[model samples]
Target: MRILLISVNRERMPYPVAPLGLAYIAGALKAGGHDVRAIDLCFSTDIEHDLTRIVEDFPPDAIGISLRNLDNLTYPSSLSYLPELEETVAIVRRRTPVPLVIGGSGFSLAPLPLMRRVDLDFGVVGEGEGSIVELVGRLEQGASAQGIPGVLIKGEDGFIPPLPLASFHAPDRSVLDNERYLKEGGMANLQTKRGCPFDCIYCTYPLLEGKKCRMRGVGEVVQELKVLQAEHGADYIYFVDDIFNYPADYTAALCDEMIAQEAVVKWTSFVNPRFLTTALCALMAKAGCQGLELGIDTGSAKMLRAYGKGFDKEDVARAARYCQEAGLPLAVYLLLGGPGEDDATLQESFALMDRLNPTAIIVMVGIRIYPDTALQKIAVQEGLIARADDLLEPRFYISPLIGSERLIETITEAAMKRQGWIVPGLEINISVPLMEGMRKFGLRGPLWELAGRMRRPRMRPLR
Candidate 1:
């Protein structure tokens, strides 16, 4: 079987993320004895021409399209990728009569709505690696893919819950242009684990990957890092894990393995504030972790509980202090304007950040609500959205008390006063050209340190 996997993510704002999920699916297909080829539309200048050329040249038996994101997730300036995905699907449908399958984190989040919108033969929910291989095998046999786990038939009522994989497959980097990602994006990405045990209200990670953390073998992770460093010429790696620090024993062992194997790759990951410790931070730093991106969300005690964050303000500050003491640059992300957000909670967040003084503070005003999330339920209860809403189009949860306008204004005012504060919703601190120039100058990792160094004009208070 010849499988053509296409990644339709073209958002290159902060940085272009290589389609690691698509690469994993391609690897699984190859391991199943199928000829797999991939097309990354991230850097494609002419999508129609590229799709035509690839279809005519390879002429695949099955086509799999990976949708990375539903939207930019930035409120006020939110951009949807559905149009591009629809266009790509239309082009492929015109080019080939083969079966069109859609999967990836974006598609997995709302498979039913997406399957209805896009003309696709199948949709794989949750993880694609195992399900894709099974679906392909069933297709090859000309059998009904009815019972396959995670495989959703077009116009189906409901999807089968994705079965847990016994083991994970290594991603096939050779299937895509990895060097370009490393050069253009400044870092290669790999996953140390799947699943998120945290219960954040606005997060879809647990739905996409089960709540239980399924860690990759530490040795396997280290080897992939060495390969990324050696073969791909990637000096930096970003662990695309939900929470890299959770299950502290596993993190410690992974770091120990990386050190023992001399992986020598500078890395960063989304660290959880609740689980981080001084010892773990030091171990991570010793294992060549260049920085940490803490998803602290908010610093107010009330907002923390409202957001269903397990960590409190003290934990956040402790996490920041530990990272700083370990000599690791820390980037903190705050998702303001959730359910109970107001002037007091917002000020608490700013005050806490001022005290902790992280390397960078990336602030997003509104919470992008997705279906099947706690936030979705809250939105429905509050009459923000109907219960039957599929939420295919981007809808955000801004507190009715504060409203979007005042929320943005308050954050923008506070961000302008702080040196390291970055409000992406208002486009205050970061820009694409600036990031490109920094990457061109050989900067790597999250590059939050450099972003923190950029100056912001302080604005006077409105009387």
Candidate 2:
């Protein structure tokens, strides 16, 4: 089968993210002896024109498009991206008759709603490499699609039940954006595991990879890192795993194996604050772990519990200290306002921020409710939202009880004082080229400039 993979993400908001997910799927299909081509909407002069050219030239047997973010334009600030997506799809449909499939981190969050809205022949609900490979094979052989896991097929009857989640091989790094990633001076993204056990209300990981965490063998992980270093000259890798700290023994063994092999690639990963300790931090540092990003969504334990985050604010501070002690940079992720948030709690968050003093603090506002999260239920019960379809784009809030006006004031006052906090809504950094790009496209102007200056560097909480 000949395949064409398109990444439709245009928002290079923070960093120039290459489409590792699409690259992995492309690689898997190619490994299975299919021809593959990739196109990123972000790099094109005109996405429609480039997409037309690819469909004409390659004439793929199947087409896979990734929606990394549904709203490249942020929520509350902007609305539905379906129009942009629909426009892209129409152009592609006009050029080719290939099966249209949609998958990505963004799409995985609300698959059913997206499937209904878009003119897709099928949709991959979660990790797409294995599912796409199987779909292509079945389509090639004219096999019945009834039993394929993780596949949502369009039929005259209506959308069919998606296939059950199927087990498959881990993605090899060769499948991702090598040249672009290299040119951007970015680290290769590797997933040592799938899924997350923790169910933070705002998180989309569980919806995409399931709640039961699965790890690749330590030997497999080591071999892949060795290949990345030797073949691609990749000295840095980002473990795009949900929780690198859970199943501590696996993490330790993987680190030990990397150290033994002298595969000293500097790596970063998401760490669970509760599982991290000083000894574990020491082991990670020994293994050449560069930094860790902790999802400390709130400094208020009440807010944390409301969001189903299983860590306390005190543990968050301790994890930051431990990572810093072990010579690791820490990135702290903070969610500004959600259901249980109020002025007092947010003030406490700022006080906690002063104490933690991470390398950087990312303050995102509220949770975006999708079809599967507990947040969706909460959204309904609280009358914050009325339906699942509200997730067509990033419909979000700071919460009425917390009150958007007050939340913004609180964030503004804290950011005015905190040198280490980076608030995107506030736009603290003026010179980030991505901001320039957004301005060039008429997204926003001096407002973004204000945001740039107010933003702080990224902080890591644990190794």
Candidate 3:
């Protein structure tokens, strides 16, 4: 089957992302003896015209659409991409009558609702590699494609179960514009593993990729890094893994391989504070990791428990110190409001962030609730939202303990005093525009470093 894969992510606030997910699927489809081609809409000037022309010239028997995110995932603006996605599907449907199969991390979050909205012929929930190939076979044979695992059919009740993450491999970079992506993005991206084992309350990673962590071989990962360096001319890489440092041994082994091979690619990723060690921090820096995004959601231990994170205040502080001592740039990400969140916890978290004084602090004020997450359950039980409702349109769970108004006001006042601390949701934060400008000047690899370097704690009277 000839398949045309489309990447529908156009949000380029931080930077235009290379469609790594679709490339992986394209590789799998090719390995399965199928003709595969892809068009990344991230850089497309005209979505409809370009997409239509691409379809007109080399129409396929099937089309796969990858939706990487539901929204901007920022606050206040809370821009929804559903309408744009709907239009993209409409354009494709007008051009081709082939099977419209939707998959990707975002689609996995609200597949059924998205199906209803987009008029897709089918949806591939979670991982699409194995499911997509099996699907194409059935479609090509003109056989009943129903009951295929990991596939969601319109008007169908259940989907076929998905294969394990171990079955997937690193993405195929041939279909991508590596140089262009690297130029605009300031760095290339690679995924070393799939899945997230952590029970972060509002996280959608596990729902998208599953709870069990599945990793590519250390050699496989390093070899890809070498390719990025030599073939793609990639100097910086971002390991798009949801949680990179987990199962400590794997992280260590991967770092060791990079050291042994002397791979000349610097990278960064989201680090699980629970397992971070000073030794591991030193190893990562030695292995060409330029920075780390610390997923320390909050500082208050009580709030940490309420947020369902596995780490405590001590764990977070220890990890911060390790990164600091290792001289690794760190971006501390904090989600302030959740169940049991109050002014005290909020203030405490603020104080703690002030102490960490890492590279940058990204503050997300409200928790965007997704189906089946602990946050979603709490939102439903608290009558914040209906349990049966689809949350595709952006339903955020803000703690009533402090109220959104006061919470935003306090945080805004606090962030003004602290440079490099950004809240992109509430107001127009400087990071977005600043990073975009920096990218123009050829700076990349998680622009949070810019924010961190700009951070200068100002002395203010205690309230």
Candidate 3 lDDT over 1-463, as tens digits, reads 8899999998887788898889989999999998888998988888988998889888899999999988987665589998878989989888888889999989989887888877899898888888888888989999887877788988776776676656567788999999998888888988888888878889888878888888889999899999888898999999888888987899999999998988856889988898999999999999888989988888898999988898789899999999989989888888887898898998899899888888788888788888889888889889999978899988888888987888788888888787778677764244455667788888868777775555453222212
Quote the lDDT for 377 in model 2.
Answer: 79
The candidates, ranked best first by TM-score, are 1, 3, 2
Encode model 2's per-residue lDDT on 1-463: one tens digit a residue: 8888888876655545667778778778888899888887766678778888878888888889898877743433454566767888999999988899898877877677788778998888777777788888899998866666677777433333444244445554554566565445356677788777787887777767777877778888888888777877776787877888888888988988988988877778888899899999999999988778888888887888888888898899889889989988777778777887888788788888778877667677666666767777777788777764547767675677767777777776776566656666555332256444444443311122233233453222201
Per residue, candidate 1 scores C-alpha lDDT tens digits across 179-221 of 8888888889888888888789999999988988888899998
Tell me the TM-score of each prediction against the true structure: 0.97, 0.88, 0.96
Model 2 root mean square deviation, Cα atoms: 5.5
Can you tell me which runs of candidate 1 are displaced by over 4 Å? 457-463
lDDT-based ranking, best first? 1, 3, 2
What pairs collide in candidate 1? none
lDDT of all predictions = 0.88, 0.73, 0.85
Model 3 segments beyond 4 Å from truth? 427-432, 455-463
Q: What is the C-alpha RMSD of each candidate to the true structure, in Å?
A: 2.2, 5.5, 3.0
Question: What TM-score quantifies how close candidate 2 is to the native fold?
Answer: 0.88
Error of 2 at 316 (Å): 1.7
